[model samples]
Target: MNDHPHQSSSLTAQAGLPSELNQHNRRADDSAWIEVVQHMDSIYADLVHYQVELEEKNSALEDAQLFIQSVISSISDILIVCNINGEIQQVNHALEEIIGKTAEELLDKPISSLFCEQHLSLIAEFPEHIRSGSLIDCQIELISSEQKEIPMAINCCARFDHENRLSGMVVTGRPLGELRKAYSALHQAHEKLKTANLQLIQSEKMASLGRLVAGVAHELNNPISFLYANMHALKNYQQKFKTYIDAVHVNTSHDELQKLRSQLRIDAMMDDINPLVEGSVEGAERVSEIVQNLRKFTTPQEQKKQSFNLILVIKRAISWVLKAAKTSPEVIHNYPAELNIISNEGYVHQILINLIQNAIDAMDHRGQSKLVITVNKNDDSVQLHIHDNGPGIKQQNLVKIFDPFFTTRTVGSGTGLGLYISYGLATEQCQGDLTVSNHKDGGAEFILSLPLEAGK
Candidate 1:
């Protein structure tokens, strides 16, 4: 051991003494040191590898988390997460802004409290969709802190856990207040349309009634003329009676006067009571009938359907037109059998009055006025034809005849809404068709076809 530069290092080889032993000792010693050094190098390399790989994995995970958060905050709509029990777990700032409530206040509160009475039941149904893992798109109203209601369309989807249990829901809300406003505007427009339609019908009815009144006045003329003539006769008889009385007074009853009084029953000629009573009663009855027709025509009876004599309505319509026009428009009605068409009698009269009056007006610019009306029936329908020997409609204007506010007459003389309303009633309500055309016979004819028994 003392022979070497370091006695301890050489001592072991000196003890071996032989060449092979010394070489063996050196080899064993070198091998042992080399193995130790190699083990240390391998351990160092493993530590370096683990450190770099861990750092790279950590950076990747951080990037992924950042990407998720970016997506969550970037969207426009309100994003909310709710548990299956309907408690808000998380909500974005947009939802908080809309509700005017912080996420702190929303947590643990039932999601239903934010909705009004109308949406309460709807919200209750959301859990069903959540449990079924179904998506629901519904329009709902959210009550805000300021007491203002906000409409939203909730697009909700189910979120499940690892075990497939209903864990929560993810909902994205889209504002619907503007859409609601649009729908409301549409509804108001619809109501306005209804009002306009009703007004059209009322205007048509008034025009018809005016014409009917004129006709009734004309119809009363015959009875009035007869009554006046009868009264004149009565006056003459009175004068004769007075003369006989005077004769009796002057001559103490001349034989001729006395004989005449006895033969003619002059004793019963006290103011001609019998003729006066009969004529007055008859004339009063006629006036009453005419007045009744006018009343019925003007009545708002279209609200209820009724069965009435179609012939009576036609008569009233003719009377009204004739009375109002007060012209020599020769109107001829050719009808067979009595008609009892069941419908709104008022509107029936309205349609007829419009057609007849329009016919008269068409002839107003002409010298010779003539009209022909024909009423005929088939097995299930009635046909009414009104013809006027007036200037026929021009080819260009035929299509626009039924348009509202379109008139050929001078301003203030016609409203132009007549044919439009009449056409509507005859076709839409009466289940009938009304059309105008130039007849082969030279005049214009307005034809109305209506069902006799059943109506639309």
Candidate 2:
């Protein structure tokens, strides 16, 4: 009787529903609330994790910025950054040191203002061309705040935004004064080395001359001895003729005068006198030739290159070599009558003489020894091949033949420098080449190819 509508419905629901059903519904509600609370807790934890990750990333970005600033400040090279309008936007401390201007003073200024007036055009064109993403390196002079000029080598590159549009240019420059000084030092060192090498070559030549002096002395002695002997016989003949003439003037008996003339053997002596005079003259001439050649080979002369007949040089070399040679190896010349080469004549003579002597020594007791020298001309070059008829070089020794102080002869018999010196003379002084190989038929063959033009 006391129930209102809402109270009546409440009372009915409570009475109609089972107690287990109510408890089961309550348990379901508790389970759903627990799930909602757990999901909220999980979302809170995830939010905290995300916040920490963002903080770490921000820290890393700040470190990277600091690192880049440090690099730009501490680097010695001048660093400059400009906007597309060619106005200075940023520059490193090195730029300030180079131009003697603060960053604030340089900002918004045209990049060309820092360059020399003549070099301004290069700066003007650089920005436009840098848009094509090309790096350009050029030498330019920059006018400092104090009006002093500083030469620099600058490497310029374009800076682009993520969309690939050019935003600005980054230029790095380095002073060239130190580089130039380094180059000068290197050049001086090179000159010194070249001079030292020439001295060494000269010393080697002296050593070669020393080895041949004994043979040269012997060569001179032969002519001198013959000339001296002929002079003695001429004096004796003169004395005998004077005695016969005096006997005739004294009005001696015909028999005594005849005896005096016969004692001198005047008729027979007259026949031999002409031959003795000729022999003496020839001996004197031979002595003169020997002295002249020795001087030509041993005298120190300037390294002046000139054009001359190679045939004459060969003949002179052959003559000198024949004087010192133990055996006369027949030389066969197959060159042009007047082949000309532009090089140092003395050095060429030395090389040929060494070659001829070596060829003679290789023949030993081998019968039918010959040194066949053939010179042929090609375009721009002349090749001289010296072929020897003797035992060819061993295959194993061929590779080491050109090395200095490498030889097959006995210690007392060779200095091991003849071929080495010849090779250096041809390749270094004359800009030519010397090579050796075994002859197909027999013996060793040396081929020397020289340029017809000096210093070719």
Candidate 3:
């Protein structure tokens, strides 16, 4: 009966144990669920923080982009972006403002189309320049929507991608109207300064020449006067001797006369004395004429307009040149005997002397020299040609022959001032033109054209 009771109690305890275990298992499950909920809440909070941070970063990126656009739009210089093919891809507001065209209209157009002819031609070289990674500053002209041309100075550089590959170009332009105007003014000023310098140099040359001529004339005056006086005295003595000889009596002994003639050497003296005296007189007169000519050259030339024989002046110049050169080259004067022109005689003389002397010098260099002078007269002007059979001037040096201090002769053999002064006298003083060229034959020909009534 005790074993029965113990078994019943064990069953009861087992039933109570089931209930107790059920309660304990429920509490453990609740604790585990609470921990799982806490872990999920923590994960949700971290995700929310990440989303908020991402949104803030996106907003900052947008602001930076907007700031760059504003800066590019506000800039006054035209900013252009072109693709590798030089096609316009983007342009700033400044470009639209300058050309009065919207970016939409220019988006696919060629960048070269906006440039003028000259700059358009340079488009073919743009790729090479870009390839070299060089910045080019070019003067270009831009055409506006209304067809107005605007000058600009553009600075262009190549653009590259993040991978360092050429993608496009960036160009900035500035208006160049004011700069071009400034440059033009500077160029004109430089030309004026050059002209003034040439005039000053010419003035100095004339002044020096005047001083030299004055000194030479002063020195020659005394000698020429003495020579002239002595010549006249010798002539008078010859005349007296002739009278005395004529007064000799006819009854004089032949032997006595023969002895007198032998003692005096009368025949030989008579044959030589007159020519010697004539030559001396002629030389003195020539010296006197040269002195006068020198004085005329130095003195202030008055435009004392008068009618004078041109042929006579030419002959006088030729004579003076022949005397100075001491060589008789054939000079053919093809002109009217008494062609007269109204001008300053002294200046004309100066011109002819210079031309003739140049011709003579040229002839001096040749084995067989010839000079042919021809004159042509029309109602308005006269043209004189001095042609010589000497080596012609080089084609390269022809243009510079009249420039001051330009010469091909040895240093002391020629003063380069001759042709320059001749040109100046012909153009400025005589109101004429002097030009030179090689003749058909192997020689140089100088043509001088003068208005009949210069200064009229």
Candidate 4:
């Protein structure tokens, strides 16, 4: 009985050991299954993130394609994108409409097919030329859908890829007919502008002349009256001489002849004749000079320039302007006796007259008005400075002083083109410059610079 109980106890222990081993193996397998599940979850998360990024990139790509299409469609000039082999890869709407073909019909076609037979050789050479440098404004003939030849000015440049290699050519063209029309319209506008400018200048000149008419009349009257008085005195002296000679010829007594001579004042008349004649001649010459100056100012500017005495011109301009001026400003001349230059004399005269007139106008109502004119010589140019002791030009007005029709004068008192025209004539016609500024001593100063030689 004791041996049987020991055997049973041994069997129970072995059975218990197998049961513990199975439980440990089951726990270890559960842990491994949890680890596998975690790894799968991590991989799934990465796949979802990658998918979202791909969608965003696809959206951006779509936007870029739409933008490119819109730009290509909106271009007015015909555009063609070709491969390196000169085969058309893409084209704009303008090209489609101009060639009367759809993109589907034109794609992959040889570039030579779009051009006329005569231009095929030139079009072939374009690729070679484009490799070296771009082809600009090359005139060529294109073949339309109806096989009609159309003239075009085309520019071709090599298209580059991301690697900076020339992958293809991009050609843009405009119709020659449209270009010619544009040029014609521009030319017409330019001509009209020139005509209007000329009209303005002439109108201003006439206005200036009109303003000076009273002064000119008064100027003419002085010499004329002097001439008339001298002529009258000469006539009376002639009559006296005639009477005395007739008495002598009639054989009157010498005493009676001497009495007649005394009554006629013959000795005094002889003494006065030479001086009166000289005065009359001087008066006539003065009248002639005034008339000549007036004529020059009135005449249209000559095409050919001439060498003239600038000092004399300034003096004449001053005389003309001062005569018409309501106020008498003391003019100080700070220049040599004469300065000669080669230019349009009439233009210079007009410019000086306008400047001087402006100065005089500025000095109106001012006390003790003074004008100082100075000339300075340079190596290749001459500068004339006209300064006036009057209310200086406002800082704001200085910049706009040369603008057309800009004025500070009362209504109808001025046309405001005087300075503008003067500036234009100085800079454009004479190849010179004119500027204005406030003087240090309190006045407006105008500086005019002229080149010594004529502009070619």
Candidate 5:
């Protein structure tokens, strides 16, 4: 022991311990080795289990990345992800198509590089709002490789990491020019559909109006017809009344003689005879005229174009409107003489009827009304300008007046389709132009430029 550099406490034990004590120390050392071996085994098992969990977590992360990349690839609209430092970390297939750059070329580039100098301000202005968790919709113009400018709608939102911290941005871009074109096309289609529906409703209303006008004209024809027939009878009765008056005049000197005569019979015969005969003839003529006009106005004939007298049709139409409004008041016309243009006579007549009657209705329940129809023959066309002294359509609504179902009047009073159908007829059937504008005389003026010669 003295030769050794140091001695363990057990090895340097004073010589007092017996052989039993020495054996006990050996037992203690053995117990320590057993404990150490068992503890090392437990630690090794824990380490192996931890390594398996690590591998599993790494595999899940890789799968998630793959899934995200697949989703971005399927989308046509541009998808971009940029880090918080504004470096573009990821871009999808559509981004290459939009920017004319490959993924390798765009990666690690500044996000602001996508926009030009003019549009970069919008990004700086709105990026803070986006980072604060607010979604934004904006427009940005991107410059392509060949210096082409493309307008796009950019929707932006903040992207966050697993720690709930903002780490990057996700922007979705869609081309605006194509979208705008599509929208315009859809809007036009909707407008056309609306027009068709209005035309149908107007057709139904016009049919009814034709029937009503026919009824009124028919009613007037009867009285006028009778009166015209009895004109000769009225003249005969007038002659007899004159004879009776002369007899009375000659006998005025003898009141007593007159009293002695058949006073009641002579008085009664003179009074009823003249009035009955004269009134019937006058009324019957008016009734006849009204009926004739009504028949011609509502002539329900299939279209067969032939050489027909135009002045006659206009006269028939004007008479129809006038006779229809006999109960209310009179509608005077400045109808021109002998306008002979070849058109579908029935349709032309109907057109004239509508224009004239519409004017009369404008003067509804008024004391006096005036509707002027002036026709001028051009080298190849006949121009008819119909004027009314009623409320005119406003300038803003002038163009829309031709739109179906767009009427300024109250419901059930006017169908907005009158002007529309009239326009269609003038252009389609007559091969003419029909237009309306506010006249300086505080009324609406409708001008119909009809072809002079028949359209074969």
Candidate 6:
């Protein structure tokens, strides 16, 4: 009975041990399952964040691609991107339209295939030339899809990669037909502008002439009146001499001839005759000179340049301008007796007249107006300085003075083209320069620099 009870206790202990073991195993399993679930949740969170970041990056990449495509499509110049082997890799919309093919169809095409057969040798040399340096305005004929040859002015430059190594060449060109059209339009516009400029110059010249008409008339009247008076006196003297000569020819006695001479006052008439004759000749010469100056000023100048006396032209200009000037400014000339130069004398005369006139106009209403003109010789040029004792050009107006049609004067008093045309004539026609600045003294100074004759 003791052995059986021991066996029962042992069996009971063993069964209780099995139940405790099962409970321990379940707790351990629950802990492991909880750890696995926490790990899975962390991984899912990371994956979600990465997915969002990837979507944003993909959106940015798409935007960049669209921007590039739009730029390529918007270009008007035909653009071709090629590989080192001279095979076209990509092309812009202009190229696509010109070639009459889609981008897909043109891809991988040999660049030389687009050019005419005559230019194949030159086209083959382009890669080597581009590698050395950029080729600019290279004119070649391109073949269209229809086999028509189209002239093109293409510029090529080496295309470099991120590594700074030249990979291929990028070619950009425009059809010559389009370029010719643009050039033709530009030429037409230039022609119109030239015509308008000529008209403006003529109008300004006429206005200047009109302003001086009264002075010119007065100038002519003085000599003409002198001539008239001298001619009338000569006519009376001739009549007296005729009566005395007729008396002598009629075989009058000595006493009678002496009486006739004394009666006619022949000796006195002789003295007056020389004076009248000299005076008439002087008046005639004066009239001739005035007419010549007017003809020179009014006539159309020839294009050919000639050697002329600069001093004489200046004096004549001063005389003409001062005669018509509303203000009687004192002019001081400090120059050599004569300075000869090779240029268009008429243009120079016109320029000096305009300058002198402008100076006179500026000095108008100013008390004791004075003009000082100084000439200096340089290595290759001569400078003529015209300084006026008037209020210097306004600081704001100085820059705009040479601009066409820009003026500060009253509307009808000036055409504003005087200085502009003067500048053009100085620079363009005479191969000289005209510049102005405020003098150190209280005045405005204009400097005209002109090239000297070849040897003198």
- For model 6, what is the error of residue 268's alpha carbon versus the real structure, in angstroms, after optimal superposition? 38
Q: 284-397 in candidate 3: lDDT tens per residue?
A: 665665567566765855545688888887886676566557467988889988888887666676667777878888778677778898999998899989999988899999
TM-score of each: 0.38, 0.42, 0.43, 0.47, 0.40, 0.43
Deviation from native of the Cα of residue 125 in model 5, angstroms: 2.1
- Per-residue alpha-carbon lDDT of candidate 6 for residues 187-281, written as tens digits (9 for 90 to 100): 99999999999999999989767645634564565456667777887888889999988888999999999998988899998888886787678
Write the residue-wise lDDT of candidate 4 on 1-456 in tens digits. Answer: 233434544565666767676566556556666777999999999999999999999999999999999999999999999999999999999999887989999999999999988888888887898888756458898899999888999999999899999999999999899999999999999999999999999999897676457445635654576677789989999998999888989999989988898989999999999978876886687688667756866784545688888998898778666644678889999999988889887678768877888888889989999999999998889999999998999998888999766789998777677788789779987889999999999999999999887674
Q: By the TM-score metric, which is better: model 2 or model 5?
A: 2
Regarding lDDT, does 2 or 5 come out ahead?
A: 2
What is candidate 5's lDDT per residue for 1-456, written digit by digit as tens? 223222332573566577787777666666666777899999999999999999999999999999988999989999889887678899999989887999999999988788877977777755587667788798888788787888988998898899998887888899999789999999999999999989989998997786456445434443544444455555765666666577677765577546634543556656666766655654555555445655665684334566677778776666555644543344344556666667777557656766776677666655555566777777898878888777777779977877766766787666555566667668877888888887898777888888876574
Q: All models: lDDT?
A: 0.77, 0.82, 0.78, 0.84, 0.72, 0.82
lDDT for each residue of candidate 1 in 1-456, tens digit (9 for 90 to 100): 223334544886667688777777677667667777999999999999999999999999999988976887677788888888888887777888888999899887787887777888878888896677667998888889998888888898888789988788888887896567889999999999999999999998897765555445545654465566667768877787787778777776477887878766786776467856675665566667557755765673544567788887787677656645647687787985478877767667768877887888889878888898899899888899999999888889889999866789898767676788788778877888999998887878899998886444
TM-score of 5: 0.40
How much does candidate 3 score in TM-score?
Answer: 0.43
Global lDDT for candidate 4?
Answer: 0.84
Return the top candidate by TM-score.
4
What count of clashes does model 4 give?
A: 0
Segments of candidate 4 deviating more than 4 angstroms: 1-28, 212-456
lDDT tens digits, residues 41-140, model 2? 9999999999999999999999999999999999999998998998999999998999899999999999999899998878889977897667899999
Mark the regions of model 6 whose C-alpha exceeds 4 Å error after superposition: 1-36, 212-456
Q: With candidate 6 superimposed using the best TM-score fit, by how many Å does residue 92's alpha carbon deviate from the native?
A: 2.7
Each candidate's number of clashing pairs is: 6, 0, 0, 0, 16, 0
In candidate 4, list every pair of residues with a backbone clash.
Answer: none
Error of 6 at 126 (Å): 2.2
Write down the RMSD of all candidates, one decimal each.
Answer: 16.3, 13.6, 23.6, 12.3, 22.6, 14.1
